[model samples]
Target: MTPRIHGGGDHLGVARWDFSSNANGCGPCPLVLRAVQEADPSHYPDPSYAALRSALAGLHGVEPARVLLAASASECIQRLTAWRWRAGDRRFWTPTYAYGDYAHAAAAWGLVRVKEPGLAQLAWLCDPGSPLGQGESPDAVRTLLNQTPRTVVLDRAYTPLRLKGDSALSAEQTDRVWQLWSPNKALGLTGVRAAYALAPLGAQPDVQTLESLAASWPIGAHGEAMLRAWTQPEVQGWVAASRATLTQWTQALSDMLVGRGWAWAPSEAAHGCAKPPHALDATALRARGIKLRDAASFGLPGWWRLSAQRPEALTALDTALNGLALEVAR
Candidate 1:
């Protein structure tokens, strides 16, 4: 735990607990950092966002008008709040990790907050987790959505960027799926928070209002440039490399966990969401200078989420975990 400098990414130093996220280090893309400083995508200094939206819209199979790019998914949560009341102490959330801030935003909106071992109206779950990279079941999701219609807002972010199985909310459907995807998280453009929403496409006023608000206040110039660069062929090459790297790291990490007599999450579901929650003791890990997020936050105390972000991090984790005695795995 360190002072998050508004956005200074020092969560990298967490030898044990990676609270920040597993964005799998973005490599030399002709798209970011000094590249932006060098060349520019300002073919139209006052460009038409249509091109950007069109690209993402086509990818998601949505109309350009349905596409609304925002600074970050957090902005989407705020926009969601504009439609839904923000406070009254009456609301709902389910077990989750790494929600940018949707539940907190809902609470801020003033409503009767309801949480528990089982109070899941609007289940805020993530398949194939944030930092851990596990996947979950669509049937499970459908069940949750069936439990409560027009209430749930699932996060289907990592499902796309990384190569994966069928996402519970990736199709051209899923009305309850209000997915917020960030290239920064999966594709590694953390600075450029250009993300899109994959909610239901329809004549809903709520969605239209959110879309209009986003268009009028789009993701800005820097984000637009980052998106353009990421969409470039050279940059996409980086994504492919990153995916391969992740696959390798994931296998190594899984092997290490198994060798240590712990269960490695299956890849069938998406990030490790299908696997049951488990964790190592923080007090013992603290002895190793490994501070972990208590899984209790996501309903599994001290069991920090771990994903094979890259080869190096996975190696480090395997080494660290291997050094531990069998007692710690429990």
Candidate 2:
């Protein structure tokens, strides 16, 4: 099995100035935080998650029956792949560069990777995509919808945290595909493992299969609370307001990097990739209590993906880079 490659706090512990994760730099929204903190762990969550599904469904203006819960986005990816495979999907498609889990899950099921979208039985799309933060083209999505893929899942993990531009797919187009949402990132509560998907219109049969395949009580009380809080108006408002601050921080971070001569791939989200003029020494940066996500795992070697961080974190990054430069000069 290929080891999963991900960013954020790792075995050594959290980075003091972590730029590895794409969680909302300004949050752990207070309201959501309170909900999670206050969650009672004395008992199990409702096995069926009825109220939670209704709330999530209402948030997206979909039927509650269209909701499918998962322990996390990655879990959903694995389960969905397994579901499709059991149903006889032998080929899958993913963007040229995308979340590792998509390919990982497919490989686990012995599904062949197909380059062309139409050749796939299962496909994954991430709008405001990771590593690049580029939005998918609506026309392309429309075209794909008209194709033969039995299951097309749009990972909306970054959509809530998008800093600029709108989602390319409109509501109607969105209704034609599965919309997988992981709010933990948007709420700055990545530690919380909770995610749900809105099944395509009239996908009840598919939903039933997915549900049957799910482990009972997939979400515990804390995850349940965090997700429930996500449907609240104030929590949404908090997330919306944080974007302004993140936008400012993003500009400052971009200016700092550009000034240092790094090649930037501008993103519409708080996080994006850039190639440092020289190959970075991950250990050296970690020694300085700072961390950056190397893009090699995402197939963009020599480039690093960084999220918009606070002024303090940016200054720390600058100092760390200077130290590296001095070492190179020596």
Candidate 3:
């Protein structure tokens, strides 16, 4: 069951941390804008977005051909879902999670979504377990891919997480791992709507079809422009700064928790891959005005996750959480 969202989020917006999302609190990256400035919808994306592919390929140490661009990681998944499954086919995933949209897409096309593995024909992996932002080691991930008989749809939305010691899948190394990178979370490209996928080195049967699915509707000129912005040097510096800022907030939240007599799980990446210390009762926190995210929705009931925010916002959150302790003690 969906844990109730305390205070019921208002439609347009609320304090965004409620979603366990990432943000720099620094708006509109100038570098991101410059990259987008080069976009020319008048001419289709340069036969094959060569420069864009080259930049990412060089970074990931993969040949340029292995990369595929899409509007977003979610869109990439939807395309993959279309290629592999059929009506009544079981789409397996862990529970209390994200990808509710993926489930809905499957249903619209007559695919069955199975939370547990009961005759599942296909499985999509959400690493670090959804809302909790946890990650499995590379070896652990390798094991799951090898063990699951169903075709694996790798959704590493939050994997390769954090600035220091991040772990992204190598597109060139693994065939089963079709990894996704969401600049929205990592790069704060929320409205930019640009994501890319990495697949096996073999000739792709799904490529044309996936491309068709992606291109069926026009790729907006503005979105294309925004994507180009992601490849700029100025943007890269901004990205680095944002990452550092995110790291700071993550540490602040952790320290505040410990000060409050709470503990957190071991984290690989600084901010994104952590679990609430075993005693952090997210459900209890909700009873106060804390507006905690339900990690239960992401397969872990006890943990809670928060996104990077302005220092002022963090201060407010600290006040709310401290008050929760007082209220709970009473």
Candidate 4:
């Protein structure tokens, strides 16, 4: 049976205090916003995306040939899985609780989910991982890399939003596996779908094959503008500055949850998980313009994952929690 793909931002209409999605709370960086707004709508972006790819490659200190752009991280996951399936890979493995799309894509492509990393033809590793926001061990990464006849992709979507701790992989270690990045989250532009991947140093042939499977002009003008702005020094500086604010917010939110009898889950990133003392009336919270992600979809039942948001949002959440507590008391 195929697993369901669940995400934080659903079509339930926008919430006034949306702590469900992990997008940077401090951004839509001003510089990036302006760039995207100014993008020409009359003409198509250069079909090759040469300049944009080169900029991203330069930022990561990789060759332009190693860059693979996608419409979004989800799209990239599906495309990569399809490519692997076509290449006769039928076994997949994920090191920890991950975004739902990885498992969904594998199931859609008829790939068997494997328990052992070494036995799978394809593997996924996310540093400062989703839902729980914990980094992987370097030893585990080395073990996966040493596994023969395997293709490993490291999802780096949250790397930019990490508030504390560091990645387990060194530059040398990371170069041995595919690195997938989605700048939209860091820039607070999740509405704009754009992502890119850096292939392993000698995986040019594999990268070329994946590119061949993609549709013509995979990214539109606005996405092109967003990706282009992501490589700028000023935009990166803004993101770095925003982390300080997120750190403070995360600490405040954790303290609030603990005070209200919720069990705070340890995390190093800007987002974390917490288990409520009792089952929550999610529908009630939604009506109050508040949203928290149910972590059950990420494999942790009875827990919710929340992104660090502004003080106003936190206050709203506190009020909602109080109301729920009163309801339970009555």
Q: Give the root-mean-square deviation of each candidate in angstroms.
A: 5.8, 1.1, 5.2, 1.2
lDDT leader: 2
Candidate 3: worst-modelled 10 consecutive residues by lDDT: 1-10
Q: What ranking emerges by TM-score with the best candidate at the front?
A: 2, 4, 3, 1
lDDT of 1 by residue, 83-141 (tens): 55522224556444445365566556553345441344344566555534555556656
Scored against the true structure, residue 72 in model 4 reaches a CA lDDT of 91
Local distance difference test, candidate 4: 0.90
Clashing pairs in model 2? none
Question: What is the Cα-based TM-score of model 1?
Answer: 0.70
Model 2 C-alpha lDDT per residue in residues 179-206, reported as the tens digit of each score: 9999999999999999999999999889
Q: Against the hidden true structure, what lDDT does model 3 obtain?
A: 0.57
For model 3, residues 123-236, the per-residue Cα lDDT tens digits are 555554454455544654454455555555566555534535444345433466676666555454566677887765563555555666667433456565665555556666
Worst 10 residues of 2 by lDDT: 140-149
**Which tens-of-lDDT digit does each residue in 169-266 have in candidate 4?**
88888998899999999999999988999999999988899899898898999999999999999999999999999999999999999998999989
Error of 4 at 247 (Å): 0.5
Error of 2 at 77 (Å): 0.4
Could you tell which candidate, 1 or 2, scores higher by TM-score? 2
